[model samples]
Target chain A: MSHIIKPILYSYWRSSCSWRVRIALNLKEIPYDIKPVSLIKSGGEQHSNEFRDINPMEQVPAMHIDGVTLVESLSIMYYLEETRPQRPLLPPDFIKRAKVREICEVIASGIQPLQNLTVLIHVGEEKKNEWAKHWINRGFRAVEKLLSSSAGKYCVGDEITLADCCLIPQVFNARRFHVDLRPFPIILRIDRELENHPCFRSAHPSNQPDCPPEAIK
Target chain B: MSHIIKPILYSYWRSSCSWRVRIALNLKEIPYDIKPVSLIKSGGEQHSNEFRDINPMEQVPAMHIDGVTLVESLSIMYYLEETRPQRPLLPPDFIKRAKVREICEVIASGIQPLQNLTVLIHVGEEKKNEWAKHWINRGFRAVEKLLSSSAGKYCVGDEITLADCCLIPQVFNARRFHVDLRPFPIILRIDRELENHPCFRSAHPSNQPDCPPEAIK
Candidate 1:
């Protein structure tokens, strides 16, 4: 076995994608350092040439671990599951594992992308909030319906899988856009449950080192 | 061992996400049937209650395999990798597998979602093309840079991986939006090469049963 080193995550306090990774790392009891890349400082620091070299997509949370740099939040989460299989974020059954990933992709690809910083900036100020709410609500509707059949006190089941990591961060984003949570009671319930979970709490944006004082809730 | 049933893929010919799964099924040599879901017919058939039940997200490329239904192209792809294993779409090395998924997520989440049919409709006819071109360009710039270090005969290496399944369809969408391909030579070359490969050729939108006659290249 290769000697393991502490992972270093390149993240921003308010990025929901970064929060997903933080939750996963904490759940696995992995100790990792954070390098905050302010997305809004004098234009996005993610656009810097140096940061671009780390993740050509110029997104987070990227991580350096096991002698390699990895980018894309879902990819990083999967990598951790593969390398650090002790805490097991994915279910053992093939079908159940796919379902967990299905929820992750819905939020990661379907909902989150449309409301991300890059897309919102292009949406322009006048329509940004409306645009974010529209997509988030659309995605949450689907999630609520999926959870109707899939949930067992958490997104996929009673156990906290990677889906919970994905769900908590997305719910946090939905709240940021002031989306009506009543319509997604299942998601709201799951989020409420996860928010108090030690791993999720430790990884919350409010607790991140880079969170501005006023933004901490 | 339980007998495997031929999978049934719910797909829309021009849907890049659906096309990604189609390519994977083809590359895996898995004989599967296609159930067409028209994304543009009188609103979307995906919104119908029956279809929504299959995938509450109302997205195409949902597959019925191994006696259970699966949704989300990447999830379906991963499930296939776990079950089918033959004609693998992921590399054996953990880091290489993570890189392949990183490229897939970059295109799948970062680029495709921003320009999907649903988002384009909201973008409106006036700015839709410009909107698609902008996101596609930004994402292609990142994919192009990542390919500089990762490419051989395909997106990850000489043997095709899930990344190529994603890259080809996104390139197809890029062409549809009239984005110039000159700046992304590696992508263009890999695409040109893959377009002729039998698996990709079979899965091309033009050859699909639902492909409108006029849309065929």
Candidate 2:
């Protein structure tokens, strides 16, 4: 077994995607130090030379575990699951594992990337928020269908798998964009259930170390 | 093992992302039928009511395997890996599997979504190709750095993994967009090697059932 050293998570408070990882880390009871990377101020601190050295993509939620540095929230979460293994986030069976991963992929690949702040910037300021709402709503609708088939109290058969970790953050972003949740009853139910979980509530954007007061207001 | 029924892949010939799954299916020796969903002509068949029934997102490359339906290329690929374990596309060890998935995510999540045709449509026609080239180059550069640390004969190790499956299609798209590949030597080398492989060549857009004559020109 690898030595238990507290991992360091480099993240931004308002980044709902980063909030997902924080919840995951807490759920696994894995202690980690936080290094908040301000995404909005100074034209994105993640773009700085030093931060880019840690993550070439210059994205937040980069994790340093043991001696190795990991980038991408999904990758970091998977690594923790593998290295830790006690509190398993993925199912044991291969088929179930694939299903869990599928739900996660739908959010991580199909949804989150399109609605990211950087991509919104490229879409132009006038339509940025609208673009975010459009993609987030589109993604949530599809997620609603998948949840209709696969979800059970959580994204995949009731356990707090990696899919849930990916889902809550996206829902948070959706609400921020003012997407109507009435259309997605399944997603709303899942999000409501997840919100009450201690790990998830503690890691909410409003509770983060770097969350801006104005944004909350 | 379950009965080996012929799989059906609903995809478009020119869709670079769909082409990734095509290569994987071929590499795994899985025989399947190709059902074309033309992205052009009458503003995309993917948006039609019929296709939307199969895929709520109305996206290409949705697979029908052994009576189960799967969407998202990464998810479908993982499903294939699970159902057909003989030809493993992922490493056996946990960390190695996570690394291969990380590389795949960087392309699938980070690169491919940004330059998707739908996203480009919003950017306007004149800037569409430019948008594709910029994001492809950005993604390729990141792949170059990742491959520098992890690659050998392939993206992860000597054998072909999911990372290689993703790289070939993205490289093809980059070349199509006229993004200079000379700067990414390692990525180019890997592409050259995979390009020569029978599975990849067979799955090339030019060889698909619905490939347009002009695509080869």
Candidate 3:
């Protein structure tokens, strides 16, 4: 095992991917430090060469832990779950585990990246919000159905699994973009129940140290 | 352990995400049957309500294994690894494992979803090729850099890891969209080396049962 090293997360308050990692850390109750990387300030600090050295992809939620620096939000969460393995974030059963991962991918790949900052820049001003809503709604429609079968108090049968880590952040993002959450009662219901679940509540963007003043309001 | 069950993979020949799952199955030497879900013929068989019962996401690469249906290619691959751990697709070391996942997410979420069939329809006629090329090239640029420090004969080392599962498919798709490969020598080199590798070769779209006649040529 790697030495008992302190974990440092490079994060931005509003990045959904960043929030995913935050939720996982809280779920596991790991003591960690946060270094905020403002996604919008000074033409996006993530694009700076210094941050690029930490994560070549230049994305927030880059983490230093267990003697390695890791990038990619879902990847970081999975790594934490694998190494820590206590207060387990993934279900032990293979089938339920797969379902948990299925939900994570739906948000991580299907929805989040489609609305990523880089893609939106290329999409240009005209279609940015349209593109976010297009993919988020398209993904949410599938997710709402997927959750109907697996969701209980959380995304996978009352456990605060990795899927819930993914869901809370994404639902938070959806409301930010005004994607209209009313159509998905199951999702809204789950989010409502998770409003102050402690693990997820602390990870909410509004609670982050670097969360913008206006964002808090 | 769950009963010894015959795996049934719901897949499409040309879907890169499906290719990721197929390659993993082939690598593990798992004997699984493929149920074709045509993404193109008659407006996508995956959209049928019957198919939706199988996968609410209406996407190919869902799998039925160990008496449960699993959706999302990455989830399916991870489940196989957890349940059948013989030919492991992830490295043992935590850092290498994180790197492998980072690469997969880069392709799965960062690249694949941006150019997904559903998103392409929204991108429309004029920007279709541009959009594909734009995102593929952008992602490849980041991937090429990530691969520099980690890659050997394969994506994460000499061993065939999950990252390779993702890279081959994304590279193939890049070629389909005419994304220039001249700059990404590491990616091209890896793809060139994988050309005749049994796992990837057998899983290629052209080798699949449902590969279109034109695609075969």
Point to the candidate with the largest DockQ. 1
Best by TM-score: 1
**Cα distance off (Å), candidate 3, residue A20:** 0.8
TM-score, cand. 1 vs. native = 0.98
Tens-place lDDT per residue, model 2, A1-217, is: 3446778899898786688789889889888889999998899998899998887777887888767777778888888887788778998876667768777877887888888888878778998888888888787877888778888888888788888988998888888889989999988898888888999988888777788888674
RMSD per candidate (Å) reads 1.2, 1.8, 1.5
- Native-to-model Cα distance after best TM-score fit, residue A216 in candidate 1, in Å: 2.1
In candidate 3, which residue ranges exceed 4 Å CA deviation? A1-4, B1-4
Q: Give the DockQ-based CAPRI class for model 1.
A: high
Could you give candidate 1's per-residue lDDT for residues A1-217 as a string of tens digits? 4436688999999899999999999999998999999999979999899999998888788999988888999999999999889899999988889989999999999999999998889899999999999999999998898888889989998899999999998988888899989988899889888778899998999999999999886
lDDT of 2 by residue, B24-128 (tens): 888889889999999887999988988877777768889888777788888888888877887899988776777788789899888988888877887789989
Q: Spell out the clash pairs found in candidate 1.
A: none
| TM-scores, each model vs. reference | 0.98, 0.95, 0.96
- lDDT tens per residue, model 3, B1-217: 4545679999999999999999999999889999999998888899998998998878888888887889999998999899889899999988899999999998998889888887788889888989989888878988999999899999999999999999999999999998889999999999999989998999999999999888795
Residue-by-residue lDDT tens digits, candidate 1, B1-217: 4336678999999999999999998998989999999998979998889898888888797988878888999999999999999999999998899989999999989999999988888999999999999999999999999899889998998989999999999999999999999999999999998889899998999999999999787
Note the B-chain TM-score for every model: 0.97, 0.96, 0.97
**Candidate 3 lDDT for residue B217:** 54
Instruction: State residue B169's C-alpha deviation in candidate 1, in Å.
Output: 0.8
What's candidate 2's DockQ score? 0.62
